[model samples]
Target: MATNLDLQEQEQIDAVKAFWGQYGNLITWTVTLVLVAFAGWNGWNWWQRDQAAKASVMFDEMDQAVQAADADKAGRVFKDLKDRFGRTVYAQQAGLLAAKVQTDKGQADAAIASLTWVADEASDEDYRSLAHLRLAGLLLDKQDYDGALKQLDAVKSSEFAGLADDRRGDVLAAQGKPAEAVAAWKKGWDALSDKLDYRRIVEAKLTAAGAQPAASGAAQ
Candidate 1:
């Protein structure tokens, strides 16, 4: 019985060795890859958090500059944020805030530069739409009708479609294309949700432009 038991144990050991021989490298490689991926994920998360924290500090600095109404300082801090932490949310916020300061300070060129960066580089679609919309308005103020229309054309978010068409109408009107303006305004009015008071404002524009407004049930 002892000899029989020894033989059975040896057979079991040999079976395990055969299995290991066939799958050992695959198992080893899979485990090694899993560990490396886990480590890389953790490292990437840590790096992102570190970057955001530093970017937040710079954003705060830009905010202070904006509050002071110091366009120069805001622009400077925004440049630093763009250079060092441009991929962070704080950097996008800084660009928008600094642009606002620059606009208010009559620094149109600086405002345009900051807004252009946000329009081109903002990761969030909503932010990109916002930047493009604001940039359109700035271009309009400069009487760059073609540039304004181009920016409005670049707005991709459906959420901003009504606003974009409204701005497009404004640009067309400024360019002495009253008929085109009316058409654009009609689209804007049709796109806006009835719940929005701004929709009514667009409706008024349509009426004043001697165009009939599209009928819609009033928001309950």
Candidate 2:
């Protein structure tokens, strides 16, 4: 009985060894790939965190330059931010700040350049809309009516619908299209909530443009 048990144990050991010999390399390779992939994922996340931290510091420097009203310094720092971390939110915010300072310094071309970059390259839709709005204003100031309209056309977010309509009215009014301007202002007024004080301003615009607010349209 002891010899028979020993033989059975030896047979079990041989079966395990045979199975391992057939598939051992494949199992080893599969485990190696999984481990490498996990390590790579961890490394990528670590790299992004480090990149964001460094970008935040540079953004602060750009903000300080903007606060000082130093357009050149702000532009320089903004260039660094764009070159190194243009995909980051901090870089997009820095672009807006740098553009404002440039505008304040009478650098319309520089401001337009910065705004264009933000409009074209920002990943965030809200930032892109803001860039478009500001760019349209700048173009309108330069008497580029068509350019202003084109910028406004790119702003399609519902959150910015009211402002975009209002800006469209302004541009149309500047182009001497009173009828279109009034229509645009009516849309803007209707888009705003009744509780907002800004709704009153939109209503005033509509009144000035020979249009009645929806609430008063029936009375007229």
Candidate 3:
């Protein structure tokens, strides 16, 4: 019986070895590919973290320059951040801040240039929408009605739908299109929540444009 058992075990070992011999290379290669892919994913994550860390430090420097009211220094740092990490949220935020500083210093053209860059190049949709809104407002202040309307039209976020509509209404009103202004304000009002105090402002705009507000219950 022991001899029989020994022979059976030997046969089983041989069967396993034969199976492995037929498929060992494929299994090894499959495992190697999986491991390499996992390692590459980890490496990419590490690289992104390192890049974000460096970009964050530069953003803080830009903020400090802004707080100090040093426009030249802020502009220099912001330009560096944008050139090096334009895809970073911090870089986009710095651009907005720098544009505000430039505007406050009577640099409307420079402010528009900065805002235009962010509006066109920001990786974040929300940031791009914000840049377009601000840029449109600046252009409207300069009475560039067509340019303002174009900028407002470029805003892409549904969340900014109300603001964009309201801004568009303002532009249309300025251009003596009261009927279009009222229609835009109505759309904006309908998008806003009933509880929002801002809705009242839109209602007032519609009223001023010789348009009647929808019934209070109709503002869905």
The local distance difference test score of model 3 is 0.87
* Model 3 lDDT tens row, 70-179: 67776787789889888778889988998888888777887888888889888999989999998989999999999999999899998888889999999998999888
Clashes of 1: 0
Regions of candidate 1 where Cα sits further than 4 Å from its true position? 194-197, 212-220
Give lDDT: candidate 3, residue 108: 85
Clashes of each: 0, 0, 0
For candidate 1, the TM-score is 0.88
Descending-TM-score candidate ranking: 1, 2, 3
Question: Model 1 over residues 1-220: C-alpha lDDT tens digits?
Answer: 9999999999999999999999999999999999999999999999999999999888888979988999999999999998998999988989999999999999999999999999999999988999999999999999999999999999999999999999999999999999999999888888888889998888888889999674753333
Candidate 2 root-mean-square deviation in Å: 3.6
lDDT of 2 by residue, 129-159 (tens): 9999999999999999999999999996677
State the lDDT at 88 in candidate 2: 88
Best of the two (1, 2) by lDDT: 1
Report lDDT per candidate.
0.92, 0.90, 0.87
